[model samples]
Target: MTKLGLEAKDLEPTRTIFHSIVSGFSCSPIGRIRLDLFGDSSHFRREPIWFEVVDLSSAYHALLDRPALAKFMAVPHYAYLKIKLPGPKGLITVTDDYRKSIESARDGAKLAESLVVAEERRQLDRIVALAQEASTAPIPAEDPADKTSFKPSKETKKVKLNPEDPSCSKYVVMGSRLDNK
Candidate 1:
């Protein structure tokens, strides 16, 4: 619209909302406009298209949907990366750059990965905040009379390692509950 020297006031108000499968959200269109689209010098189409003005950055300026294709009576061949439509003189065919398409796909993949990482970071931040909150809470002191305290069940006797050297003697504690086998 800016490129064509058109302002927001020029657009016809639209109440329609559309969903993006890739972004997983719904967006209300800014407005609708009947723009003259040219396939070539001979083949041209005038279609009313709804424009969703997003705040976020994108790789592509505009993404045409099935409705736009249907209006032009265009058939897209994905394998050949071409769109064909009936022209007044003959068949109007538009070809896409293979390298540019690959580049765009790569950029889209990167954007998706970055979004996932950002979401994961947000979750981790929430978990950290919860942990910090938990850590700040006061803990009760353990009671000496608690029955859950660990205790050895067997009685033991101590035997000195060196009987001749009493000062250097080290004693080993042996349990009476030992089996002879």
Candidate 2:
């Protein structure tokens, strides 16, 4: 239809500041609300022709299944969707493409996560390999200090630990706690 020849009523979203535009829909109790990103700061010049009246509960599902949520953060954020209204000459469509920003953020986040995960895995693998190598390799020989080479002073070793410390009765304990109270 020649809506251009007719009056052109701008619209704005009452709920969100999305770039969505609607036409030929029923009015609400508050009146028609068309959320236009191109709309002025006052939002007074705009009026709603119709409402999507969506519960929006299914928006997530729709975004995931239809819009391929994996592709981008198509979670019905503000400043999305496009509007093609009846202008004086032709259809005046206003589109705010937020896809680039959304994609940029998403791609950066994914890359960062992947790099972190890969680095964590690499560290874990190195630790595991070191543990395995330690298990397989033979222990280093303790170089015996010749007691004969040292001269005994007037103060002899008189502490005389009989059976040595109780902890020395067995090998060293690893991790958490030890039953040896």
Best by TM-score: 1
Q: Estimate, for each residue in 1-181, the C-alpha lDDT of model 2 and write its tens digit.
A: 0222322243333543223212212223222233322233433223322333322111121121223322222233335555344433444444444665566557656655665687689999999999999999999876566653554444433232334675544443233333335
| Residue pairs of candidate 2 with colliding backbone atoms | 11-34, 12-34, 12-35, 13-34, 13-35, 25-50, 32-48
- RMSD of model 1 against the true structure: 8.5
In order, the Cα lDDT scores of the candidates are 0.70, 0.41
Cα lDDT tens digits, model 1, 63-137, are 667987887788878788888877666678878788787887787778767776887899999999999999998
Model 1 global lDDT (CA atoms, 0 to 1): 0.70
User: Which candidate tops lDDT?
Assistant: 1
Local error of candidate 1 at residue 163 (angstroms): 48
Poorly placed runs, candidate 2 (over 4 Å): 1-96, 147-181
